[model samples]
Target: SQELEQSPQSLIVQEGKNLTINCTSSKTLYGLYWYKQKYGEGLIFLMMLQKGGEEKSHEKITAKLDEKKQQSSLHITASQPSHAGIYLCGADMSPNDMRFGAGTRLTVKP
Candidate 1:
């Protein structure tokens, strides 16, 4: 089993600004998934990575897996208030095993 550590446990950014959140793994990562959760809402699947150096983007948000497969980063461009939420990183250790980080709370100021 591997442990996931999400940096900046919380963040505050002005609207239209850019920000980044990082996730580190205690062991080599085989599969990684990024999710966002709004206040009092379920998690929304953002992106998934299975190969090293893989990158994915949706609208203003982008996610990437490092070449070493031990880290991943999520970047939000021209962030907005709508981006305020808790960002979670999950690692798929096996078919039946998955672990998640404590989650990063984002606050986008107007």
Candidate 2:
């Protein structure tokens, strides 16, 4: 699916493993937003970028925006069990639009 579908709806890895999740869209993304949320908890703001081909990262996670803006990727390095959570990438259909994928549920084993 090109409508912002993420792979491995869920992932399980060891405490210090590395992982990557992808987001694909049918059309170019004018705006991209990534959010991290713990189960039953609120989503903590991660990053948002408007310029195509732009990328931003925080802590152990990195997010990139494609020049075509049709795809994006999020990679986590040296994952810690505490890093387990849901990662969601969204595209703006309108200034107020925020469509999200089902999400990539990450589980880091201790």
Candidate 3:
């Protein structure tokens, strides 16, 4: 089984600043998914990467997969209070094996 690890377990940024979160996997990733969730709320799917060196962006958030397919980065531009939440990176190591990082908690100061 594979496991995902996220860096900077937590972050606090002043409003309008930019931040980046990294996710690394112990095994090759077949598929990588990013999700965001607020306290006590359900996870909200943000992006998915299937190919090596692939990237995707939605609004002010961007996600990228490294060429090795074992690492991913999520960049947030112009951080806002609305962006405060826990970000999770999930990976499918095999058809039946899936794992998720502990999640990175972000806080935006006004």
Candidate 4:
């Protein structure tokens, strides 16, 4: 929304490829989150970065928050057809305020 911004609003990857998406904020982030979803489905939490310079990985996915707490990145390795979907990045500016990106649409070519 207003507090968060994401880049490269969309991406396309070939099967077995790797890709990265970035999110940025103007204010310091209290918490940063990554999510994945398919059409007609709910969001699935991928990872959360609470501290600056923090990073986490699960399976072929990895997330990182910059030391400034103003940026975050999500990386996917060896993407498959199942990886094709929408990716979202969220920022919690305060306990009462949370904003999400418009979402990056990812399409994986067979």
Candidate 5:
């Protein structure tokens, strides 16, 4: 597809539930960046992985870049409503050149 594809464009989960979102691409991702955007807010950096097989975590969310550089995943453990937002995975070809997935909107139910 030569484009980034995100799974579960929208999701609803219980406050304490665990969930995972996936991102895949047709091109080799030189780098992968994860960002979160709350409703009506700008994107907030979550993490970035320039090396394959790299995994990073912020609070309750953990993201991993597969060795293939063709896929990545974000895992949320013991989610809270505060965690609800749009999760975006962008593929970076260079420092300022990045392409984003449509995003996965996560809704954590109270």
Candidate 6:
């Protein structure tokens, strides 16, 4: 079975600082999905990457998939308190099998 690993299980940053979270897969990834979860709430869809070397951005957040398709990173620029939450990375191993990372908890201090 393949697994997803996320680094820096937790993070704390000052407002306006930049931070990045990484996710690595035990096997090649077919597709990757990024999500944000607020405390006591369900996960919120962020973005998805399917191609190697692909990158996407929305507002201050950016996501990139490595050319090897085994890793992905989520970057947040100019952090804000509103950005505090848990970030999760999910890998689509197959149509019937999806794997998720442990998740990175982010705390943005004002």
Candidate with best lDDT: 6
**Ten-residue segment with the worst summed lDDT in candidate 3?**
1-10
lDDT of 4 at 92: 90
- lDDT tens digits, residues 1-110, model 2? 44678777999999888898988888767788888898678898788878888888898888888888877888899999888899888788567776777789999999
Question: Which RMSD values do the candidates have, in order?
Answer: 1.6, 1.6, 1.5, 1.1, 1.5, 1.4
Per-model CA lDDT versus the true structure: 0.92, 0.84, 0.94, 0.91, 0.91, 0.94
- Which residue runs of candidate 1 sit more than 4 Å off their true CA positions? none
TM-score of structure candidate 5: 0.93
Candidate 4 or 3, higher lDDT: 3
Residues 18-105 of candidate 4: C-alpha lDDT, one tens digit per residue: 9999999999999999999887889999999999899999999999999999999999999998988999999898988899988899
Provide TM-scores for the models.
Answer: 0.94, 0.90, 0.95, 0.95, 0.93, 0.96
Q: Per-residue error at 32 for model 5, in Å?
A: 0.4
Number of backbone clashes in candidate 3: 0
On the 0 to 100 scale, the lDDT of residue 100 in model 2 is 79
Rank ordering of all candidates by lDDT, starting from the highest: 6, 3, 1, 5, 4, 2
Residue 41 CA error for candidate 1 (Å)? 1.9
Worst window of 10 by summed lDDT in candidate 4? 1-10
Q: Write the per-residue lDDT of candidate 6 for residues 1-110, one digit (tens) a residue.
A: 32999988999999999999999986888899999999788999999999999999999999999999999999999999999999999999777789999999999889
Pairs with steric clashes in candidate 3: none
Q: Is candidate 3 or candidate 4 better by TM-score?
A: 3
Give lDDT tens digits, candidate 1, residues 14-68: 9999999999986778799999998678999999998999999999999999998
Cα displacement (Å) at residue 86, model 4: 0.5
- Candidate 4 lDDT at 37 equals 89
Error of 6 at 37 (Å): 0.5
The ten-residue window of minimal lDDT in model 5 covers 89-98
- RMSD of model 2 against the true structure: 1.6
Q: List the residue pairs that clash in candidate 5.
A: none
Residue-pair clashes per prediction, in order, are 0, 0, 0, 0, 0, 0
Q: Which has the better lDDT: candidate 1, or candidate 3?
A: 3
